[model samples]
Target chain A: MSQFLDFIPKIPVADSVEDAMDLLTDTFAGFFDVIKKSGKFSMEFVTDFLVMIPPVLFILIIAAIAFFATKRKFGLAIFSIVGLLFIYNQGLWEELMNTITLVLFSSVIAVIIGIPLGILMSKSKVAETIIQPLLDFMQTMPGFVYLIPAVAFFGIGVVPGVFASIIFALPPVVRFTNLGIRQVPKELVEAADSYGSTGWQKLYKVELPIARPTIMAGVNQTVLLSLSMVVIASMIGAPGLGRNVLSALQQAKVGNGFVAGISLVILAIIVDRLTQSFNKKRQ
Target chain B: MEKIKIENVSKIFGRHINQALKLVEQNKSKTEILKQTGATIGVYNANFTVNEGEIFVIMGLSGSGKSTLVRLLNRLIEPTSGNIYIDGENISKMNKKQLINVRREKMSMVFQNFGLFPHRTVLANTEFGLEIRGISKEERRLKAEKALNNAGLLPYKDQLPGQLSGGMQQRVGLARALANDPDILLMDEAFSALDPLIRKDMQDELLDLQQKVRKTIIFITHDLNEALRIGDRIALMKDGEIIQIGTGEEILTNPANDYVRTFLEDVDRSKVLTVENAMIRPISLNIDIDGPKVALQRMREEEVSVLLAVNKLREFKGYITADDALEASKKGENSVINYVRTDMPIVPPEMYIQDVLGIISDSKTPLAVVQEEKLVGVLIRGVVIEALSSSDENEGVTENVSIS
Candidate 1:
């Protein structure tokens, strides 16, 4: 029975799937190139500013935002400054700033793209059905699998890293935004309609404001996911502590990997707390 | 002028509205239409006119289309095949822009659930309709504040809807509708969400506001008492069609059909029927000419144990029992006034039967139905009993029929 099962013909899906995908890719060749060029420009512009800004000013800016956000300003500021200093003192300041640039750009682009898509999904069931499964696949696919296509499209640079990070991080924002709007009470919608509000007026004044907290949560998740993709992103020549961690793994250097990993953890904590407080303030 | 007029409006919920409407035109049953076209009949063949400043109630139990009928007036639920004229404009043919304009300027609704925006403060919520219309912020604030004050919610203006009790929240809903200063108010079970006590308070509040604003109102309710208490005219719905439309008194005294009478089976007749409704013209001898002999003769002729006495002005004097009149006649009393018993029950014409039930029960002689200090009618115990009992029997028959 086992030999008979083995003798059964396979679908040969993988071999043909690649051919079909390549044809599909050829069809959208212009669209992909446009995205690649735009991604390159944004990546350079973002990296230039991050690299140009004096490390002290950068630290101060992040620390100042942290100070205002948290009531424990002294503690948050000290933690932030010390963590940043640890990276700077380790001679990884430029690398750290590059990672910051990558994360900032990736998160911003993801949010920009995800929100309207999310809103579109909320507004129409057909869009939601078509987009939702694509999102699920994007989220569930191995992170390493994305690097192959990302590098193929934008070709092994900060742009490809950011493009990959955007794809990886976008789903949460879209999902939550759709959920937030859908969860809004139907009676409130009726009330808005009853008062003679136009569709746009209802969306902006009634639905969006009520859905703010949930959307903010989505944004937070997108940002965190963007940050988490940094290490995997470094394999494609993306800079930062992630690159150091990658190098440490390659050369078996424990101290370099430990410091880089610790710095990433610190950065994650700072971003998480800061976004949370910001979201709380909005509500 | 009629503020709102509906001309055979109907709403059938489905994609095959045209087919469903054709079936409806053929006088097909809702179930048959549903079976044929998968169209759930929401409202069917309704026609009514609400006069200016009238409270026109649409009443039915759940799924009976009261909500749909009210929504149809404001074009919230557009009619499938009929014309709704709001001050002479056919709203069914109106474009979306024109409909919005109509809703903004002419009609505003109060929902059963309050539908107050939870994130907005009471003042902001009240300002919502005006905000939608792009009214100047200062003007809207003034109008919204004025409405809040009228609803007695000014003190809670800055609080969010979630912070208020259900009654208070519904008042915010009321204030929101009122702030628009629209010509018509569509209240879809506006007070039904409240506790009974609060519902009564809100009903009274609405009545008071109606008096003040005098806007045409279309109110929806399942509660008959509420309909009777507030509706200038009520349209009772059954199976998505308006079965009867009449004033409260008309519906009570002369129900349009056995269905309406059955529907009114639980209504307390004593609460609804007035002394004027049940009272009969009194046969009273004028004290100016009627001696005891005459009073006695009048009592015998009327086939009664007692006779009512009145003066030349028709002012109610009292009542003289047949035995007392006879005794006075034997003694040859000059007037029936000496034998007159002043202890009988006397009620005003407008007093509800329930209010006089105690007095009627205590009196041996017929109660005097007086209006402006004049003897208008007499309410005998037997007559009041008959009026109450016959209606009760009718209700009893309806109850058993419905149950079976």
Candidate 2:
């Protein structure tokens, strides 16, 4: 059995795949450049705007948002105020802003692309069969694999970081949207159709409204996943609190890493609570 | 006018449609076709015509294809073979645009489970059909409000469907369909979700609404009692085939097959059989032309102690007993009108037997069935009992005795 196993030769498919990727990169070089420039410009603009805000004012704005989003609940609002003040006191405020910008961009992009694709998947069997496996591959694969292609296309920076983060965070929104729309009762769909609704009318009037809560849940998941991608993205020179954590890890600085990690957790909790409140309000 | 005509329409659900349809043509059994070709026949060669402003009911137990047959009328479930015509236009042959236009302008449907959008308020739900038709916002809103008002649901207009009771939500469903003002209304077990009392109220309300709008309606239900109550004509289905189509009384008297007879076995006959079915030709005297002696002679000839008295125009006057006639004759009364008693219960010919049961049970004399102020027939107690009992031996006897 060992001799038989040894008799099998290794295939040269890896080299062929690398060669094919290179050809694709070369052919779409101009297209990729345009996307890279635009992506970098937008990311920098958002980061600069967030950083320029007076820290106290930014904290107050977030607290107020949490206050209203949670229907005047004091807990999340108080948490937002205290948490941001602690991050500011620890001198990690700028880094927090950078991570916020990165997460914001990645999540928005993922939703823009994912929802329509999800609708397509829900509507057509052929699209579903084709896209389902791709989504599974995207979600189940280790997060690091996306960085190689991201770096290849956009080079090492915040743009490539966002591109990788989007790939990491996109599946939940797509899957949830498809699920939510499909879960609409058959009777409701028939009722809509019986009323002479055109295809688009039926989807907009009946399906999307009923599926709103489930879709919002997916969106919440996507935002959190995007936030989680920040640390991995920092490896590709994306600036954020993730960089601090990354460097602290390299030097084994336990205190620094702990502080950065805690900052991320606070941010994650605030975002989760805010999204959940919005979802509830919609329902 | 014929609003809809369904011709040889069949719906077979499966991959081997051609083989299944061939088996269907060969008159093979539904289960045999399913076994041989892996196809389930939904509706098999259904044929019917619905007149404008009529409630045409299609009824059967679950999985009997009655629902499938109703869906075929609007082409919601496309027929595998044959044609459906609406006002002489072939619905099955129409392209997508024409079909959509027809659905939008010509027909609307109400569903079994209420099918109200949980996210939408009652007003919004009611407005859905009109909105889909591209009506202007103001016009649709007004129309929806009017429909809601008609259904007595206007007070709950701003409430979501989840907040309303099942009957209220179903009222919203009906209002939604009515808001569109379509030519035909397709209702698939629309009241099946309601409680019995609410179901009865809704049925009565629907009949009341029918009197005002007069839309051609194709209603689907499994409840035979409901079909009998509202159906102008009923089509009974079994195993995807329409077994019979007739008025409720005709089907009750002359069932098409054993399946129909069995299907109807549990029906409450008092609810469906009208007084006309139980009424007999009464032995009556014209009080204006006949004297008390003549009335007594006619009572003697008919071998009855009492006689119904009418005027020269055959207008029902009252009943006269032999004693009253004899006393009147001895007292030298010219006509039996003086002796006639006006205490007997009088009913209209169209009144259901159930409605007259109390009146008949309390009255000493046979009830008079009057139509247009004329004594058309008399509903005797024995005839009513025989009709209510639905005895096979006396079925023809009571039915044949009815005045056409």
Candidate 3:
């Protein structure tokens, strides 16, 4: 039976993609180098600046901001304080800060790229039709598959880790922002149109405000997706709890992995809760 | 006199507009055009003039192209072919920037769903049109505040649309349109989504506002009663073409075809029709010259118990009853004024039949349909009965009106 099936073809799809990517990178080496330099500087500034701060002072600052945002609901501010203290007690403060920086920068960059793409998508059916399927593929593809392209494009480092996270996390914001604009009530759009609102005026005055809730939801989703890429990003030399978790797994240190993993969960909850609360407050 | 004139206007909602337009020009049926070119006819060769300061209503069932027609007037939905002239300028020929200018300065629309910005306060919503026109913040606020006050929504100026009731939100919509101070106000089923009671109030409010603003309004509605209640003239559409354009009374008295006749069948005539619709030519007895005996004879000949007495100038003096005239003749009074009773029931020709019901029921003598103190017509009990009965028999009346 094995001999009968021996003639089946095994296509080297991965090898072909790799070869094409290398040639593509070589052809655009100058562009890639510029990106590499920017990526390095940004990644270093964010992670180093965050890591240099004492964990207690950073945690207090966050708690105070949370206190102001959630003035009536002090429980949220208290929760942040307690959550950070727990992570700090576990002596993974630097790792926690590093992870926060990576997640924050990845989210910020994704939002910056995603919002314009979303607006573009909303403006043109051509853009929407082209980008939607690409977004679906980006969202559904395994996180591990993202690192290959990131590593090929930027090589291995925190920059590549950040790039992979951005690639993995971008789709929700784009899709959601497009959806948000599309979902604006036709009557409101008609009202705007009837008033002779110019394109930019219509977007800023009506479409953006109406689409705010949905866009915020998209941003929240992007943040969560970025967090989910943490451990996979660790494989590309992103320093954070993800790195500790990966090393813990390699060394079979289950207790160490649990502590690092819990800290990541803490950060994720903070972001998720803060954004959700902000959305509610806005409403 | 014409605020807006839609001439040979047509819209086909599909990509095959050129072919669809050719088919439209060929006068193909809407369904045939749709099948041939894959374009749904939004409006086809719609021709009508909305007079300045008149509430021109476009009424049809959903998908009857009423909404599409209003949208075309503002170029919100561009027509496939033909011209729309606003104040003698062809809007169809205008470029985008010119059209935008037209929208900004000449026209504003109120949507059915009260298109108030959810994130904006009522004041902000009102200021939207003014802001788009690049008005100063201070001026926009002043105008917005004035408009809001005019709409009777000043109390809710600070409230978000979500915080207000549907009626209040629609008032904000009205205020928004008003803030622009546009000469043309397009209301696309502005009150259709409202509750029955609220809809009535809004209709009345719009009427009141129209009297104040005197803006040329083109209103769209599916409700026949609403059209009849508010329209100075109404255009009834079917299959994207206006089949008839006439006054509400004209539409009812003389529908264009079976479609329009059927459309009017369910409308309550009491509210839609007026006393003039049911009034017959009144017998007038001259007050100065016609003798009491002559007045008595005229009443007997007309087989009516009373006759309206008027001066030589056709000014209504009063009415004289048969018994009063007979008494006057017995007393040898020469003029019918000797018997003319000044305290008889009189109704304006424009008074709704629903309103005349009480006067007719209360008075023994026929109610005189008076316009500016002149006896125009007389509404008898029999005429009221006949008018109402004929409204029930509406289905039989087709191609009845001689209106252009």
Q: TM-score for each prediction? A: 0.77, 0.84, 0.81
lDDT (Cα, tens digit) per residue for candidate 3, span A1-283: 8876877777889889889998998898898779988978977897789888877788889888777766567887888999999988988887887788889889999999999999999999999899999998987889999898888788887888889999999999998899999999998898899999899999999999899999999999999999988899999988888999999999999999998888888888888988887887887
**Clash number for candidate 3:** 0
Off by over 4 Å in 1: A1-64, A70-92, B268-404
Most accurate candidate by TM-score: 2
> What are the runs in model 3 whose C-alpha is more than 4 Å off?
A1-12, B273-404
Question: Which of the predicted structures, 2 or 3, would earn the higher lDDT when compared with the native?
Answer: 2
Docking quality band of candidate 1, CAPRI definitions: medium
Which residue pairs clash in candidate 3? none
C-alpha positional error of residue A171 in candidate 1 after TM-score superposition, expressed in Å: 1.6
Please identify which of the two predictions, 1 or 2, would achieve the higher lDDT against the true structure. Answer: 2
- True-vs-predicted CA distance for residue B55, candidate 1, Å: 0.5
DockQ of every predicted complex:
0.55, 0.62, 0.63
Q: Number of the top candidate by DockQ?
A: 3
Per-residue C-alpha lDDT of model 3 across residues B189-224, encoded as one tens digit per residue: 999999977887898799888888899999999998
> Candidate 1 clashing pairs?
none
Q: On residues A161-227, what C-alpha lDDT tens digit does candidate 1 reach at each position?
A: 9888999999999999999999899889888988999989999999999998999999999999999
Per-residue lDDT, model 1, residue A169, is 96
Question: Tens digits of per-residue lDDT for model 2 on A97-155?
Answer: 99999999999999999999999999999999999999999999999988988888888
TM-score of 1: 0.77
